[model samples]
Target: MLSPNTTLKQIEILGYLGTKFPNWIGDDSFNNIVDIKLSGSQHCSNLPPLGQLPSLKILHISSFDSVTTVGAEFYGNSSAKKKPFSSLEILIFKNCHYFEALSMSDGQCQELTYLSIYCCRSFVSFPNGGLIAPKLSDLNIYNCPELMWLPEKMTSLSSLKSLTIRSCPLIKAIPEGGLPISLSKLRINYHQLLRIKWNWQTLPNLKNTLSEEGFPTSLSSLSISGCPLLKKIYDTKDSENKEYWRKISHIPHVGGSSERQEEDSFLNMKQAMF
Candidate 1:
């Protein structure tokens, strides 16, 4: 148990294993803690219920070798009365090999703004039900090979601004509803599942001023690269996928290899056909 007298604004636990933080930290004793960083916890199979800390704003957890399957326990005691991570703004998870599954109760992380997940190869499941991060502005997912879908109800995040998906080879498609119109910059790179024919036919019905539900008209910048199959569709010989083509044509920045994109019929032949 941590001393009832203990009080700190920052905590760091590095290169340690079998470490257990005292539950007493959450009993109104450590409300001032703002930053917690844990790295190289190679043999640590479990984590403290730090979510109960009301003032926790930044959390970075990485390199837990023996840990697998994260569930509500990491959030807080199942019977605890308080909301978890209520004041958190930035949450990051990386380099945890065996960690899989993140199931959190609703109304948590209510003030969150930036969420990132990277290098977690074994991670498969995210919070169940639907994700409700109202203030989330930047959501980045990278190097996660098995995550095939984002939350089903992402449109609830009306404040989202920038989204980046990278190095996740198995993610076959974006969420079914497409992205929130609030998004201004979107980037997809080094993805394998997106490589093959992007089944635009399977895209969710997204709304805009011109259509019922198409791509978000508010999007200003778009980028796509390393998706072989999508590129094939872009450079096909006799093009008829205008609906798909028109969707990204207006976006200002769809970054990729200039040489290949210049040869693309989608871009070069637009004038010839018009």
Candidate 2:
């Protein structure tokens, strides 16, 4: 038995285990912990009691093969009288194939800044209203091929700065006028996307009316890559639409001779069609 005086600040447990984890872990082993990582545990089916770690700032769990369900009270039961990590800043779950949904008993995380879920094949979407962190600034979702779209309530991320989605082959469209005005960098790669249609009027028109007033630019970089099905990116006005085409055409291509020729042919076709 471990002593109660043992205040472990960080713990990483890996490799296969055949026995039930000591329930004492939930009772006494995590009081001072600020970070925890569990990976490659073959027999583990559930998490160590987590809400007990009031100071936990980062949590990463991966490769626990036998776990299939993530319960709404996984953090803590009402009987335990524990709460979510008020100081939690980052959470990452990687390669835990059977884990499906995330449920937060409360509706928010006031301090969480980053959340990343990678290669979790069974997850269908971000959790509903009770699952988001209020101060979340960066979100990355990758290789979850079954996910078709982001949650419709994403605009509630008022402080979001970076959003990246890669290799989700089912996503078909960006929610119309749904991007947060505070977004600074946006990247979408290899999604099964067919078109990007934005209503320019719905977006903040900082440049046109404030050309002389010089309002600070909020959005700086936008990139879309490896989307073979994408055919168009358009604007609300015909004149601005022409400018959009010019911008897309000018984006450089990195390729050998055949690829360059193919790009040239596409450009010629675009010019002819326009």
Candidate 3:
């Protein structure tokens, strides 16, 4: 019943707030809300109905444990076909255990630029269609041990610039051809990843390669740590192929005293090398 251009720009819905959402949210009232914080609630089963928000840019959902699923219908009816937040640029979900996966509706989140998920242990895989966000530049996944692999079509992120994955023990390898060619910074840590394979030729200006192995050419800065099995930097075959990766700045291992110290040392070495 509420119209789109309401004066409110930011809203925080807390305890017992779930039942009142559909009525509280205006059709375009949320368009100006760039930041929203939801906490201490239940019953937010799906996002607000579609076409309700045309300008929402950032959304954060935290500490809501009762939500189990999110689907396309939650955004809008099949016939109306509205996107909940077309201008949304940053989305963060934290401490949400019941949420298993998120499948974006068609033509949703076209301007989304960043996504961060933390402590959602039940998540197994990302949504289908690779959830492309043409302006998306950063992704961070942390403490989701159940996540097995990244979306296979991840290279569709043409504007992605930074990616960080930490404490995801089940992930075995980076998705083949998944890394975007426009990527400039990548950091992966605490995953059970055993191999690092990438199309080095596609990433000609990659300035940093931080992992156990498979660094490409033009890697002016490199760091390898937390990998006890990696005794050598490069295989004998690749070592002979010197056209790529003319110099490596730092190489450290987990056998050292502490991870924090080792990472610091690696950074120091990188600074010196550059």
Alpha carbon lDDT of each predicted model: 0.68, 0.62, 0.64
Greater-TM-score candidate between 2 and 3: 3
- The full ranking of all candidates by TM-score, starting with the best, is 3, 1, 2
Q: Say which candidate scores most in lDDT.
A: 1
Clashes of each: 4, 0, 5
Q: Please, what is the TM-score per model?
A: 0.71, 0.71, 0.73
Q: What is the lDDT for 15 in model 1?
A: 86
- Runs in model 1 lying further than 4 Å from the true structure: 1-5, 22-27, 190-274
Model 1 misses residue 125 by how many Å? 1.3
Please, what are the lDDT tens digits per residue for candidate 3 over residues 1-274? 6444466778776775654466545355445666677776666665555335676777787766766556665455455455556778888888888778877755778888999988888877677767667788998887788888876667888888877677777787778665788886666652243354555567755734433445543444333345654333333244453322233423322121126776665455334333
Please, what are the lDDT tens digits per residue for candidate 1 over residues 2-104?
Answer: 3644568888878875655556645546888898898898766877677788889999888987777766667776576877888899988889888877766
lDDT of 1 at 156: 72
TM-score, predicted candidate 3 vs. hidden true structure: 0.73
How do the residues 200-246 of candidate 2 rate in per-residue lDDT, one tens digit apiece?
33335211222221321333433445644433434223454566555
